[model samples]
Target: MADAPLRSLFQQRFGEAPDLPEILATNPEITRLAARGSCRHFTPDQIDPAILETLCAAALCAPSKSDLQQRDILIVTDPGLLRDLKSLLDAQEWIADAPAMVVFLANNRRQRQLQAWHAQPFPNDHLDAFFNASLDAGIALAFFMIAAEAAGLGCCPISTIRNHLKEVRGLLDLPDHVFPVAGMAVGHPLRAPEISARLPLAKTVHHNQFADITKEEVSAYDTRRLAGADGPGWSEAKAKMYASPQRMDFADVIREIGFKLD
Candidate 1:
């Protein structure tokens, strides 16, 4: 839009910038999706149950580890329950505005139950089961987000579901081997989000072996990202925020959830 070289740079950095003719002729359904990113603000309009089911079906179509199919999705529609969940998850206010919320669970319990029902030994109760369940659930969540966005919905993932692990499980009445991996808030976006900058492909994409990124590469990215209002930019903001000692304590939470992931 500025100059040919700048347009080329835009294409290289992001995928492409639409021309005027393209914008007038093109259907934004797919074109807009290519520029997809997160939206934190959402409209309070309720999403239809039929559309939500379709999104869940699309999510279930995601690839699973060895086709074990251990992931489960739980939809939360009750306002009171949502309030409780919000309080448990550090009261992220955006969540309260979402008309639909989903909890993705890593469900190892079902397999163990099947093994027991079939009168099998079921002795493989080590770390792999837990890891596989979590991995599968995570993949499903990714698919769900993409599918929801394509369906004209916005989604934000809340990992703070891990913060009150026991309370979440108790509230959901979960079994022993099932774990709450992540929560997703879904609704119509109140406003479109600006595309966030990503590091150049050369920094991320490796030809054969893993390529190392240098300080120079990071500096270039910082400059590219900060050309916005109130941006000390992505890298600096992240660095300053995480520079302080942060306590994630994920291991302890997993252990309490009956995952002996040594």
Candidate 2:
């Protein structure tokens, strides 16, 4: 049976009783931890250096493609550099206050260097290499967030860092074939954030074939999300958010950084 906290978290997530698997019901602690929301507001306390290293180690433990280990984590500790990086993100002002910031890089250069060192031909220079590195970095980012949250730290992913890709690459002194995948801000939370509601399993999950989301499902999700909040529903909010083009020129940036999308 799920513990009280796990049950409560499930209720918050689905707006009803949870029908969890036996494994989850038996291990309620993991379920509770996984259910926590992303925290944006953080306190002034700095994350300890040792704990930060441990979190990075945990992140590195994530699976890599063919054990190529194409992901690199750059911990931003320099005050001036951090300030300059924060300036690039005017929309995410809270990043300026984050005690710890990390940049996750998709490093294809390392593998290429390794191939050259072994006198091996680097045949895969196209999109597959780029895709592998990006996917590896993304996996590492997720692991880092999981580890940080488990250690009682708050983490907020900053994908907007891509908007200033060239500036960030210059600031970080990243070479060609080493692209910034994402940034994360970590610190202790000032207050716990509410768990954001997710779509029902029936709407999201599929049996064997892919399923299309119906208008009724979107309407139901919107009603459920706007129960007490004052704003547009999920569909409307996302529509407004994407009404204007965002990061449309990122492809040019990627190509400039030596990634061949073709």
Candidate 3:
């Protein structure tokens, strides 16, 4: 039955099949979630702006932080603006292939506006404010991906948009307390995407008490994820990535843009 397909996908992703309940394993949406993957290749065909409009509307319906609704989306259609953004993210070569692009923003500024409009004291302008806004934006981005994928669209989130935060903020004309969370390259898929392996459930999912991931677990995971690839293992790759001094000023820079982050 279709349940076998879901089990197979779980095996591929986690190297261990799920003992899923039949009803859950058979649900099309649940199966789709298990098989989710990012697509960086796309055809030259363009997507209708209307589809994106509906997707954004649905994505915004996702849960928010304390009903603050501190998130917004920028649908980039202008050729010049898209070109500038592509130039900034050129390192991710496939970004240029996307027929549609969208930038998700964490907009804490709206909450600030609400306080000023009602003549209320804006006391909570510290770390929690920025954290809440960022979470709202992140949740909306996840919702957008799910909605887009359901509509047969492929997308890859580019967090590198934050690497050049100064230039991007300038280009997007983002005011204080509004920050770019990520950019998404969207289009119809040119080919089926391969699922990237993930950590085993034992390594991630735990009981009420938190559990730490052991080195052995990660080593086993690295072997599964790097089976065919000749690249470094996950730990080494991540270590190299973190060695860079890039974006060390991220918190400080955000403070300059109106988040006290105290």
Candidate 4:
């Protein structure tokens, strides 16, 4: 039987968990998928070509902005390239072990070509264009992760792709208008990753009126999360992490890569 907390998670996902009609009350598939979380420890089993193709297909099925399918996925099977990228990304050794790694890109170049071929002026040629492509890419990445999990696979998104943006751009031979939004490493799971604590839904959901946040709400979250097995957790950890603002100069790198986010 699904416990209250687990069932509440399903409910919180879509505004409220609906009671299943008598006939379809329990779905093994959804229950199984909902149980998933990230997986840091992975087995060495290789994913087959057919499955990889299916995963990519599912990813691309994600909604695109204005039907302008401006996203691409680069499947990296090359060991040498992976090692080089690892070195560039501060040598995070865990990255190199994953059997498959893929870079998801925001490809604005295609739209530019469409403009040229159709003899149209690519008028919105400033920051908005870049932002749109990046958003599109991010949506695709999210869909891909959810689809992969639903298919009984485990994944970890590596935003560290930005840490070595220049190197990755060169390695992938990405054109000027194509930027790496994120990378994903996939494999079979050895064990489930830690279930990181989350703030209660009440803390986040806003009703009809824009609710003002109170100190009590914040304190309540801190106390509730810190009380679990993953105790000693506090919002201060997040504050401290962001306080110094490490890895803050990526805009300069973005410009260097020919994106004029003016």
Candidate 5:
């Protein structure tokens, strides 16, 4: 039998059982700490500076591409600055209350400067540099979240920060070849959030090749998701989100930040 917490977490995530390695079923730490729910409500308490520093260090330890270490993190602590950031995000009042805010950046400028200093031929001027830096930042963000959760801190990633990229860049005084990937709000949770359901593993995981998702799978997932919520299901929610164009000019923003997609 699976461990109680693991089984419960599996049910909360997928609304069903999880087939997994036997080791996972028995490991207490993995069963207890592997699941995460986004927390928006936070207490008035502030995160310890030492703890935040340790978490940042742990996050930076995540793998890098060719040892380039292209990820950068900015810890935003100034109340005035945080309020300014919150102002940029419309309707997200929760951000104003969070005790800590950190911005993750994909940094390509370091490598360009390195090439200039070494007088080496800088051949990688295409989309790959942008892709690698963005991916590295994403991985580092994931590591940060894991470390934060393990430390009993709650976090919510604010991707909407991208919507105001120009304003963010100006506010942070970011130079060329550095762009914001995401912002994370960290603090103690006022209340534990409900676990969100996910699409079944079969719909996402493929044996050896890419598998097509049938309408039946989508319908089933929608049904499972709607059982505990009042809003539209995943498919309808996604459709509605995409039906209205969002950040159509993000490409332009990327170009403005000195990243060449081509």
Candidate 6:
């Protein structure tokens, strides 16, 4: 049998593609998932608030860990407020053009409040509390992006919001334990997003036992990335990014925000 178009997309994204014929029954959602990319350029067509609200509702319907429901979404509607927030992200030029933006949050405050309401002591102050909330936020973010793309909107996830955590929290009026995981730029697409390269499934997906990646595997992957429009090889680009201390103080900021990451 001929390889599915989804397999072609996977090959485009990862260089090496997995052949899973049994699961190759393609659908609209599967096609979108297979061809997903981060859209940076956007047209200035204004988004309807109702559409964004529906997207958020669909996103939040995603599975929560033990139904803790720690994730939330905040839409940026005010032009002036969004402008101020955009000022902090001047490095990203596309922010000025995107018609709408939303911030995904890890809101563990509600869970803690449940304890206060029930007159029960909140004993689990370990790292898992913070980890789980952050994970939930990420899951919702993924869902939101998928839904947005499906709805014919482009999206660019702005993780740099964490670089200005204190300012973002102040600007958005985020209270304790309700931290921004990431922000998304949403609007009509000016151009189609390029399929980003990913590490091959061989290095990423393992059998029952977990395995470490080999340097040769990474170098080969880096070579594949270099052959594309990306200027630097994957290893060199990532090494450069790691060299610059972008968010080393992130833990300190989150720690101050009432996450007892013990």
Per TM-score, the best of the predicted structures is 3
Per-residue alpha-carbon lDDT of candidate 4 for residues 145-232, written as tens digits (9 for 90 to 100): 8888877778888888887777788998988889899998888877776554455555556678666657776666676656555644
Where does candidate 3 stray beyond 4 Å? none
lDDT of 3 at 227: 96
lDDT of 2 by residue, 1-262 (tens): 4466676776667665456666676584577564878888999998888898999999999999999999999998788998888889868777877888999999999999999999999888899999999999999999999999889999988999988899999999999999889999999999987788877767566789989989998888788878868878989989988898888988898888788898
Q: lDDT by residue for model 1 over 22-87, one digit each (tens)? A: 443344544455467787899879999888889989999999998989999998878888778877
Task: State each model's CA lDDT, in order.
Answer: 0.80, 0.87, 0.91, 0.76, 0.88, 0.89
Let me know the TM-score candidate 5 reaches against the reference structure: 0.95
Model 3 TM-score is 0.97
Every model: Cα RMSD to truth: 4.5, 1.6, 1.2, 3.3, 1.5, 1.6
- Tens digits of per-residue lDDT, candidate 6, 72-188, equal 999997999999999999998878888889999998999999999999999987799899999999999999999999999999899999999999999999999999999999999
lDDT, candidate 5, at 137: 96
Pairing residues by index, what is the TM-score of model 6?
Answer: 0.94
Clashing pairs in 5: none
Better of 1 and 3 by TM-score: 3
Greater-TM-score candidate between 1 and 5? 5
lDDT of 5 by residue, 1-262 (tens): 5477788787777767657678778786676554778889999999888898999999999999999999999998788888898889857888877999989999999999999999998899889999999999999999999889889889999999999999999999999999999999999988886688898777676789988889898889998988966888899889998899888889998998788899
Off by over 4 Å in 6: 1-3, 228-230
After superposition, candidate 2 runs with Cα above 4 Å error: 1-4, 16-18
Ranking by TM-score: 3, 5, 6, 2, 4, 1
Structural RMSD, model 6: 1.6
Output the better candidate (1/4) by lDDT.
1
Q: Per model, how many backbone clashes are there?
A: 0, 0, 0, 1, 0, 0
Instruction: Estimate the overall C-alpha local distance difference test score of candidate 3.
Output: 0.91
Q: What 10-residue stretch in candidate 3 is worst by lDDT?
A: 17-26
Q: What TM-score would candidate 4 get against the native?
A: 0.85
